[model samples]
Target: MYTYTEFDEAFVRNRVAQFRGQVNRRLDGSLTEDEFKPLRLMNGLYLQLHAYMLRVAIPYGTLNSGQMRQLAYLADKWDKGYGHFTTRQNIQYNWPKLGDVPDMLDALADVGMHAIQTSGNTIRNVTADHFAGAAADEIEDPRPVAELLRQWSTDHPEFQFLPRKFKIAVTGSPTDRAVTKAHDIGLRMVRNAAGEPGFEVIVGGGLGRTPMIGKVINEFLPKADLLPYCEAIVATYNLLGRRDNKYKARIKITVHENGLDTFRELVDARFAEIRGEFSGVDQKILAGIEAQFAPPPLRQAETTSFEVRYAADPVFRSWADTNLSAHKSADHAIVTVSIKKQGQTPGDATSDQMRLLADIAATHAYDELRISHEQNVILPHVHKSDLPAIYDALASVELATANVGLVSDIIACPGMDYCALATARSIPVAQTIATRFDELKLEHEIGPLKIKISGCINACGHHHVGHIGILGLDRAGVENYQITLGGDGTETAVIGERTGPGFAYDEIVPAIERLIGAYLNIRQSDDETFIETYRRLGMEPFKDALYGESARSGRAHAA
Candidate 1:
């Protein structure tokens, strides 16, 4: 984790002071609700359906024990007893009093954290692979580049008020865990012909009402040209992107309206115009940032204990199988603590659970923690020998659900329950699906599956990328659900295809069950996952299973 310098500290403190005054003014009637709206949004505060929600940025999803403890403290003291981790790897407190938000901001600042750029049209928190530093297959840690972007974009005058919110994601691994293709700007670290580490820059990708997999604008962007090139892209978008309609304001829309070739030409021209402005300053800063992210000390440890435990305990084995990933070090393992427990809100973590994770990280995980876009917590550097103890500690807090990539491990946005933009409920549907899957004891059998749900087309839950995507909608004053299949959020990014008509809220769980049941029967073998079968066989069979033979035949006849 990059420690905040004196300048960083001073800047955050000043911002906090400014926001505190704004909050005071709003409370004292000096500012109307409309007047306060943008100000509050700029500071990561949202007036939701029920209460104010505060979103705090966990930059690149990295945190230490102290920071985690502070988040836990804020959740317990000011808001509800739990906090919601979001798909952007940030955390949200759904029930905070308007007046207490300043205090919350101050408390966050105390731990070198803040809510700045967590909302609004400014560059939101720059995200990266949660397994960046620890993944075995990474060419380089992406966090340094992510941090460089965060520093460069924070309060950049040119981009402070863009046409719409901008998101950037970076991944150093060949396997794209960060959903890089679905971001406004995606950087996949790759070695060029000369074997120099550089980025394959993908632009214009986003998930919302119009979901798109980003197009590769630059096949090989030199490592040194990152900052200026990014500036060129954003600056071009700022000038060309739509301002008249919020619905079409995003850069993705701009890219869609103008052909990619034309957009590339514009970006190239802009890059040439402003590339001199950088003058190697950002590269220098990037070098310094890279130093801060060096891998932690590797300690040689025996994995015999872990092996013995795995052989002895079926329960521990189940959790380990789903929750652990390969680590860069032979003796270490990356542990993903599933926040999506069966029957619980997908990403809700109680204060105690947060504290417990903090303690576990401090003791067993080299004091490093990561929040995944999948709404899970990760201990990225746990020694294999510590697996049993860590598992036991996590189990105590009900964080030991062994469904990391399974059906029960879902990604859900704060839908109608909290979000003002949501037209239908998302959390309950996620909860019901997970609970039903768990009841069936079919999660493990189903193999790796990603089920993402969004309350609306905003796609905050990234339903567009899930293997089985569910979108909740309001139809004629009633909640309805829509399903999409074969969506993938990986190196081979593809938007999901919708399956026929929407289902009623009560019918959703059974519909999902029917779809999964159909998959199990139709798959080539148990080893062929839902996504594989969907990719090979396509949607016709799945549709038949979901809507039944009569309905499918009728729809075909109608078609």
Candidate 2:
């Protein structure tokens, strides 16, 4: 919600013009695909499986109604009829013409949004908690800091071309909703022993060929030192991060090789030298950004008896149980609009649905909306009394699925369907899993289970963090899938271990059903979730169920 200043406006305008010229050259054969690749990547354009995809950054996943409407406009006017909200809380338009991207950038800029730094080796969109400001459990709102990072990292001369793409995520809540440990740089807003809010800075965590949870670089980094410390970390990575091999280029490799103590020393040495340079500039910028995020005024009234409403309507009660969260205010609740329908691509929202959400946000939910890392949309501050109206509006648009935190509410990426890098179709696999579970009526019975799918090992779908993780792979030109068990995305985060042999494209769904069925049979009580049961009796049983006879074969094809 940060308003663009004159400086910000000028910068985006220049970027748009530059990209326009680049697109013109590409169209007229002045620039070949080889020449235009980096330029387009810098502008957040990618040549995907079918067409060019434009990834627009929704910084910190914060957007107003105007910006949402603009995204809807772009989806309707330029790209396909819908957009895909990503795990990073950004949006990808899968069918934008090369020439019209400049116009799309213009449309975004008109609403104070842009695609800059949404991709490439530079720092990607800074992500944070979707319920940052509105959550009752937050220590402080993290968007101001996320916004500050956005400004500081934009075309930063030193970090424009790092060894690999860098990601940073911040969260102010005790509950780790942002999955901070799975990012390149994780900032957990914490209160120091002195009771002053600072950050617990974690460095070098990432997922790919070599997954690592970040180590704490600094236990308590003062709020004022955020920019300088971050710069120091990026500078250190730029200088020492691996460039010899693309596979080993992430900061995780560097941190892992150098050891945390040595890396911390280097970052501290760099921080000491640059700390003075950031003295007043960041304070001024952060103050301005914080002002933009001031909470909307709420009318003083007695809290609604939401329990009474729940007792009356079973459907509403089911939805309220799954879709709503306790708000900071007494009479309000945070509503998560599940994009994971029973049998649809995860995170796909049609243009009309987007427009409808924008309208509803403006009318009933404080004109603010958030794109969550779970591939869902959030009405972050909805009054309890308005649930029925919001639910009706969202239901009409196919956004009111009551499956939040359920097994069927999976997170997946645009796999072979859109991503050129993908070797398998992740969306369809996720859809089939959801549909099968719904058919069995086993989702609610199974309780909270995170089933995340990644098209490839890049782990954009966060398969590494799911309670039940699925990884799509290519085996001898055929699509295959692997499953991992005991993974968790929480304060106590842990990477899952592979169950056994990979499943063929056709065999993956039934294999998943088999695993879930095994969990249900082995669970001591119906109250035992998949995660709890997994913790109680490791992955041995699930592995046996998934690979009944060929448990020791370790083949790519299940049968």
Candidate 3:
């Protein structure tokens, strides 16, 4: 993880102090809510439907044990006793009092974290693959570049008031664990003919009212040119992007309205003009950031304990099979501690749970931790020998659900439970679905399934990319859910197609169960995942099952 430099520390402290003054003014009634809205939003504060919510940025989703403990402290001392780790890899505190926000910001600054740009129409958190450094398939660790982007984008004057909020994601692997194609700017590390490590720069990809798979603008952007090239892209979007309708303000719409070829030409022209501005200072800073992310030393250890436990304990074996990923070091494994335990709020971790994770990371994970976009806590470099101990500690806290990539392991936003924009309740729906599936004990048999739920069209829950996506909406003042099948957020990214009509809130869970049942029936084998089956059979079989044969045939396809 990158250690904060003096400049970084001072920058955050200054922002906190400024926000404190702004909060005082609002509290004193010197600034009306109208006047204070932008001020508060600039610092990552939001006026939710019920209360003030603060989203603290976790840049590149990398932090240390101490930082994680500080987050727990903020959760307990300021707002609720838990924080919601969001899809952007940040944490959101839902019930903060307005007056207490500055103190919370102060606490965050003390640990080199803040909420700056987390809410504003500025460059949001620059997220990277959670398993960046440790993933066995990585071309390189993408965090250094992500960090460099974070530093560059922070308080950038030109980008401060873009057409809309911008998001960028980076991944160093061929397998897109970071959901790069779903970001406004997706940078995938690749090698040139000379084996030189560079990036395949993608632009205009996003999920929301208008979901789009980003198109590649530059096939191989040299490492030296990344900063300037990105600046050029955002600069181009800032100028050409729509401002009339908020719904069409995203770069995706801009790219769609004006073809990618036209947009690329503009970006290329902008790149030429500003390319000279970057010079080599960015490279020098990146070098320093790269040093901070040097992989933690790993020592070889015997795996007899892990082997014996796997053979003797089915529980531990189940958890291992589902939650663990291969690490670059053969002796190590990437442990994704499931925060989406059955019947709990997905992405939520209590103070005690947070502290335990901090302790676990300190002891076994080289003092490093990661917040995955899938709403899970990751101990990216745990030795295989330490798996049993970590599992037991997690199990004691209800965080040891072996449901990673399983149906019960869901990706859901706070939805109507917290978000003001939510049209229907996502938490309870997710909870019911998870509990129902757990009761049936069909998760293991179902294999890998991505069930993402969004309470609204904003796509905060990322329902657009789930292999099985459920979108909550209000139809005639009633909670209704529309299902989208085969949406995937991967290297092979595809926006899900909506299954005709919508189900009431009561019917949503059973509707999903029926969809899964359809999968089981159509699949050649259990090994054929939900996505694989959907790809093989198209939407007909599932559509037929979802709405019987008559309803399926009568349903008119919407373009």
Q: Please give the RMSD to the true structure for each candidate, in Å.
A: 2.7, 2.7, 3.0
| Candidate 1 segments exceeding 4 Å error | 549-559
What residue runs in model 3 are displaced by over 4 Å at the alpha carbon?
549-559
lDDT per residue as tens, model 3, 290-325: 998899989788988899999999999999999999
Candidate 3: Cα lDDT at 380: 93
lDDT of 1: 0.92
Q: In lDDT terms, how accurate is model 3?
A: 0.92
On the 0 to 100 scale, the lDDT of residue 265 in model 3 is 96
Each model's TM-score, in the order given?
0.98, 0.97, 0.98
Task: Report the number of backbone clashes for model 3.
Answer: 0
Q: Candidate 1, residues 100-140: lDDT per residue as tens digits?
A: 99899989989999999998998999999999899999999
Ranking the candidates on lDDT from highest down gives 1, 3, 2
Error of 2 at 484 (Å): 0.6
